[model samples]
Target: MSDDLGFGKLLDDDGLVARLLGKTCKGRNRPLLYGPDLPVVFLTGGPGMGKGRLLRCVRDEFGRHVPAAHLDCAAPVHAERAAQHPSTRSEVTEALRELAVQFGAWSGDGGAIGVPRLYAGLVAVAAGDPLAGQAAGLDEVRRHDDLLPKGSFWGGVLHRAFRSYLAALAALFAAQPLATPLITAILDELFERVSSEGKATLEDCYGAYSGAAGHPRLGLHALSVDFQQGGEGRANAESFLFRALREDVEAAYTSVRGRMARAGRPAVLLDHADNALGRRLLRPVLLDRESGHHDRVVVIATARRADGGRFLYRSTDADAGVVTSWSPGDGGLPVWQRRQGGVPGLVAPARGALLVGMPTLTTEQQNNEVARLQGHGGHSGAAGHGARSGTSGAAGHGQGHPGPAGHQPGEHASRLRVESGIHRLSGGRPRFVTRLGEGAASLRAPDPAAFTDWDLLDAPVRSRAEPEGRPVPVADLLLDDLVTRQLPEELPPEQHDHWLDLLSHLSVAHTGACAQHLMQARQEGRDERLSAYRITELLADSGWPQCPRHFIGDRGLRHLLMRRLYRLRPDGAAWQEDHELLRAHFAARADTGDSGADEPCGTAGAHAAHHHLAAGGVEAAVDHLTGAFPLRDPSRSMARWCEELLAVAGAPCAAPLSGAPDDRHARALGEAPPAGGDWLRRRVDRLLHAVWLYEDRTRPVDQALTGTWRPLLDRLGEEPVPGTEVLTRTAGEWAQLAQERQPLKPCACTRHLG
Candidate 1:
């Protein structure tokens, strides 16, 4: 939000976030437009980027203005009404029921916007075919005459149906374990009652699902069978239900936004849309929207990944699956881009799947929040640390860094230090910054200064730091919330330690193959104990982004795990040994192929170089980058070339180093001795140091590049993207932001590496 959105106010912005973070057009104004627009918006980001919180804010903010409903698709039906029928399908059905009931009650100046047709269908399903058939149906309708909607359609058929409809109907849904089949029957009868015009609308909507859509019974039957039997078809059925819901939305809004041309479109905030149920609900809607059907309702789904999962990026011959991302720093939307092997010319503005990456808390944004949270006008929101923060996953309290109590009552330098420390530590993640802020605030008691209490708050997050007590350590929170607690949810308690071990090892993995190799090596041929798919899925399910290039997506999670690995043994053998395992795998993959995977051998070679560096094989990493691509690329292989170089330079640090390279590191480096093997060895250390400088996001680009990178560039005779981008921009060839001149800083992982 442009305003000082306090901690947890994720959606207070007036389209500033969408404008800045996504490739969404101006149509995505505050309260987002719908109908012939990007009908579905997927809020995708790494975990802790505040997607769920944003969804809640949207629901709360828009419910007052329009017909809006929120449903967390990941959660199963636990409401008392559906407690007996606790299934994901039942959850979907209950949520749909709640939506219909809610919107059905909504009224405008013209009158009510009830989903009479859908209601009739639900009542019909709940009413079922009585043992006395038509006799019980008539009596049943009369019993609830006041409660039912104004309709005689169902009563006429039930004139001879009244034995014991209620008990039998409950049994029908309850006996089946899932209520899909019974619900499908209700849908069939509802469709039968639809007027000819309404049928045409549905026919057009469901036409894609069932290519030729004449028979309502046929369509409902197919959906019933598929929905009853879960999988891809289950998603198809959910998609159909959504279209059915859209028919209601259009019918509801037609009297207002359509005829009156005044009111806004309705919205449905769906959290965890990348999960099993959400994907199902969104699949057909996306397909239909892509095929040129514009529904009325605005569907906003929260996804863990910025692309909203692989369904959007799973390339096929007819369509390349990657969705467009307006990742924060990009100048404009590129013509085509994908993480790996995306077919050229297949991606464009015409594709479906409207996805937006959740923007990180920027240097300015974080500073504003701290100022706003401090409950004072004096926090100075304008005085930020830097522009974009390029953290080196350097999150550890080395020693002597003052905690919350160490500062004096009115000391200005200490205040700046606290703000800078938090910004650096959090790496601009909203959740991390917010939690750290809360913890820091907790230190205000007993004494105005932090004193010894500050160390507890400031200690670098470690695995054993346990998130407990009056004010939990940030490291303990990361360990417990990110790793320990989440383990039991996916795996059994006995396997928690094993998976934690596996996860720690994965902190060093640059790719999924690297992760799989770590899991295999740790398991030692006991295939049952480890499934590459399972472990990788575990990471994704735990809310860590599962990018193939980076096995564990979130930066802080990896740093946490890496520290734990070093401490697993006194000699740091567990940390070093894991790197050895990955080094060997990449070395093998580079020589042969990527175990039937499609990535080129060059990628394997690069990965090999990274692991080699992590295992202290610095010469190998340098040689790989030095020889891999042209030093100055006219073709500009800058993206990939820079990625590998940064990867090598940013290998897991064994020591907890933070901020700029000062005199301490200078003394540690000493001199390269001007010749032979020692020169190359010094270059190895400087190669790493240059990377740290380039990646040190807390400082201005000019300052970060000027330190070690300038010398490293001349020594290696190789240029990287940062060298050019930082220099030209610094040479006054480009417009510079006010925040760009701020001076250098440092930052992560779940846990292990030597």
Candidate 2:
């Protein structure tokens, strides 16, 4: 029910990420200027900034019309080939073959293949052609070679057989060549291997995979790994890969242009060209071919800033590929930031070049996301604070959305915190978020004290925490040998720290207290300030569930405060000092004290009367009943806890009530009706106080209110209380107040006192 924003889910599915990226084309202007068509176009950016996802979008939009191939550079490939060798035609060919088989080509029997068989084959082959010694629990394939043959690796065999079958079927096309033009696609990591090769191979055929012919041809579209490559090794991988992949891509592009008549659009989309690749790799791709520059291919590159050196490469000739940039900020800023700067502009000038930035989600779009998460409001399974990530709040939620009519009363809760944007947090880097999401929520729950004993929380420098607290063998880390095993491995240290810190703070109820305590401890040198800030920053940047305000009551303000705190740390010492300052600031805020009106209408000290009752000590049954009254509010649900404690201690319940019998009679308790007149109001008021208490203290609910129940219930019905609306309805229904003749003012024991 909390409207806090931490629930924004990850852009997990590639399809979703693609959708988000397409929205980035806001201006809808000319095609964005990127690299030349003759050079390989490599998209680069900080990890999770939408490089892969953007490629998927381009593929979705232009793929069918052109023989385009999408390669996920993050997929695992054969181990020996992955690290030991550069991208070979054979490996790429094998990958293309696997994609074809997995996506569904004819079977060797010339019959339609099942999607499952193809998918399984892809997973197996992608598992990196496990050695014969490693083929335990796998179906053994018949092979002529001692080890798996080139085309006989589990994935390779499936692909080769599928290709032949598909080729045979394509013969039926007559006009459209039986051989599918090889469109080799690869993501950034795999492309790094291609860049290392420094050349292209395979021929004939147009599209990305074409290179040398007679053998299987090659044409490739690949991402650049500038961030990952060591500077001394390859200062700008985009340039290197672009030049290398371009040789083949251009040749295939020419073939496609000739065959198709209209010039084929051989496009390259480069994301975040401000990095090293933009400088070294982008010049050739962006240059115009009419003045001896590379021509015929269309290149579209995107960057955060067009003024950066990467996009500033200059040739003497004028109109060298129109240099225009698209900026999203012009239209409107996203809601996440108040008055945020407009999106950067698209930097292409060609009339139909189609350059644009992404579109920001409208307010309605954002609200729809929120509504989907909160469950059309007032419905069951409406995401109670304790509900699991994606489930109904009610027990009968198994019967989810029945038809399009509406959500049934028992429908499970939809996921909360829907986040959508150009580089959606969830879809673009699903693996990263999924890993964090599945593991983090529990770690960041409102209970930091519980985590003190966690083994992962106390991890050593070189050790990885057990994912989700499930024991993962250290040896398993060794198995992650493929380059694609962990894609997008280049988050800025600050952003990484932001996410970590956010998670840590969310783990406690009294986030303000935790912050103050941590800061004070740092000032006292009891805890390392820089280390804690680093941890907090990493979590925040990663979009973990961080309290928006120091207090849960103002989560938004808290988030902003946390951001300010993080930004204040210009240097290590500065950061530590800032922590000290914040410690003092918060201490002062807490000392200001709650200054709300002190009306005690619901309370019956009549002031002095209650004091006298308490003086009588634990045996003052009336005092205990009065103190315990507030616990009945289900909104707080604290009453049940108190009831059990009293029962266990064998406490007396003969509280002073205007109507109930004296302490001497046992059956008199049953004779009185439940407490009335402002009872619900007091309960609600008391409940409000408890929200803050539950957040800051460790007192058991039962023990805290044993002698304060009656007054508390009376307070609960007060206005502005959290559960006021519900309590009002329920209380009236219980009292039948509307039908009562005497405006029923009852005693603490629920009997009419007037």
Candidate 3:
């Protein structure tokens, strides 16, 4: 397996084939074999977590032994056609045709290949036999025509009906690329006529025809064409056509199963099943256990983890039979059987289903991957020796010194440091790891001596760090490819800016962005007429939200996009403006009786206050905090905010503010309270109020304030305000009270009391 990048370990340990074939292993570590019941394996993960790569590996490994077809549902052509057609039946039909074309079942005879022909090809490969040298399987039926009960008068009527239908099929095939709805109607009529006049049913004809020597190929190709042609007929035809198509597929599957069992089970791999058509197909396969078609062919599919429950509306009888299901694991990579239920206690796996959660790389695996990328040949002894020697000279020279763990200097330490950096930056996601590695390789110094600069390996393409240290341009490039470029061209141009604004606001939030919060923000925006519901709908339609809550769902994308938004305005003006908008929106909501307004020590008020302070509105910020503060109660939240404010504004102490009348204080004292009080008296009053509330002997110092409050006390010491001596005495008393209440606990502030 080369073990070059640990791809072998990932596929083998994940149980991809066993679950698809419905095999249950005795233990977690055991290898699984393909079993009798064909399962629909849904392989789901976040974007760029290697779902596609795993599918490719599966195709390459299993294609040799069985007939396996892989279809990428995310292809632009499929999406475009689905958009144009806007019918689930058409989408499924197109998907099937694409699969057939990929598996070489479609002969390009200017006719749509029927389910029977497609099955025959699949079965041929399954049984280790090549198909006979004939393009059309229809010729095999000639030898069995006499087998029909033509002697009886009823049989005679059926025979003629069958012949007429075959002739119609031939004519449709001859025309090539005709409307599927038209052909479906013709087939429907033919079946109805035979059932009424000949006392034969659609199933009866299918059985007799398929049992024939050649199982005469019916040209079902016409059923997938654009029959409605923008007419009212198309609207009504979809439901009927879809039902007929499913029936035909099921019947064909039943016919092919015996052969497939004898030859060995064949499988179909559907990639990017999170797409519209893929989701449509997933519904029946996951929900309808009674459908014989699902039990006939082994189906393997991939989708975004967030969409794992897209098809499952409610738990059903078929909820437990899924052989293997995959979703994003806790560490954000695809693992097996991690997610139990969406709503905790209410849901369970579908009947006959085995759920698998995808896994992220472990630290060791990540390190190995980095080593492989750097061409270290799997961290062997020789490589270690070379690395240490290479970095040794540079270590002493200070170009790349080893920190703390004093190992041999240069290449080894540099490699280790780079590997650690890559793991941290990429979050052990395989796609991100690969991208970062490739980017680093391209940017690596040509000379070996300069290889230890780990910063160069940070992102794939380095952008001039605007304002330095922020990876804005690199983030922009990645987001441009992953999100901006992928956004449907149909989206309004103005919506792009709105999405960016939403992203920017969420980027700085303490909790992840919630759709509900964003809607609230939009409702409080300048345009009161804008519909929050419509904006959310547009975002969903744009394929940006990874889950219902998070827009741009992939964690890597979320991080990079947030970085890009954080640095959108280099001068910080735009950031401050966005934050103010957010603060005002939440404040308006709070004032209007929003549910979260009365939340106990809630983060919303804190966030709003922070933004207000950042925008240089200290009084407004203080008002928000004070208003939200629990009455007659000490609050750690208030204290945290106070500490943050003090750090940013610097110790609010100066000779003029303390009444000593320095030039700056004289100027400040001359101005109006709204303008000058913020920098002088009011600032000191707010800081003192916060300290006084926190130091109220009734309130015990929580862990958050244990070592934290000392910083505020120290900063207060630096200020030569009028009540400095009283504040110092107050701080000493608060420290004494804390030590008496919790003797063993060491408080940093208590040391100042001594």
Taken over the whole model, the C-alpha lDDT of each candidate is: 0.51, 0.29, 0.43
- In terms of lDDT, the best-performing candidate is 1
lDDT of 3 by residue, 537-607 (tens): 44444433433323343335545644455456664555555556766765665566553433221444544
Top model number, TM-score: 1
What is residue 40's positional error in candidate 2, in angstroms?
12
TM-score-based ranking? 1, 3, 2
Candidate 1 Cα misplacement greater than 4 A, ranges: 1-34, 78-89, 104-113, 124-239, 255-262, 290-293, 321-350, 374-378, 385-410, 442-470, 479-499, 509-517, 525-553, 566-573, 576-666, 669-754
Return the TM-score for each candidate structure: 0.61, 0.33, 0.54
Whose lDDT is higher: candidate 1's or candidate 3's? 1
* Model 3, residue 100: C-alpha shift (Å): 2.0
lDDT of 2 by residue, 1-754 (tens): 1221221221222222222222212212132223332222233222333444555555554433332344443344532343542322123323333333322322211122122222222222232232222222122221101222223322232324433533432343334422321122111222222221122232121122223133211222211122123343223322333343444334433443334432234334444433333334345344332223354444444433222222342353243244333334343211111111222122221212223333223333333433443334332233332121211122223434452355343322222222111012222222223222322222222222121111111122222444356543211221121111221123444333443333223222133433445544444632323334444443332222333322222222222233233334443233334333433443343256421112121111112222222222222333333444434433333333233222212211112211232322111122232244254433333432222222211111112322233334334545353544444454344234322211122212111101
Better of 1 and 2 by TM-score: 1
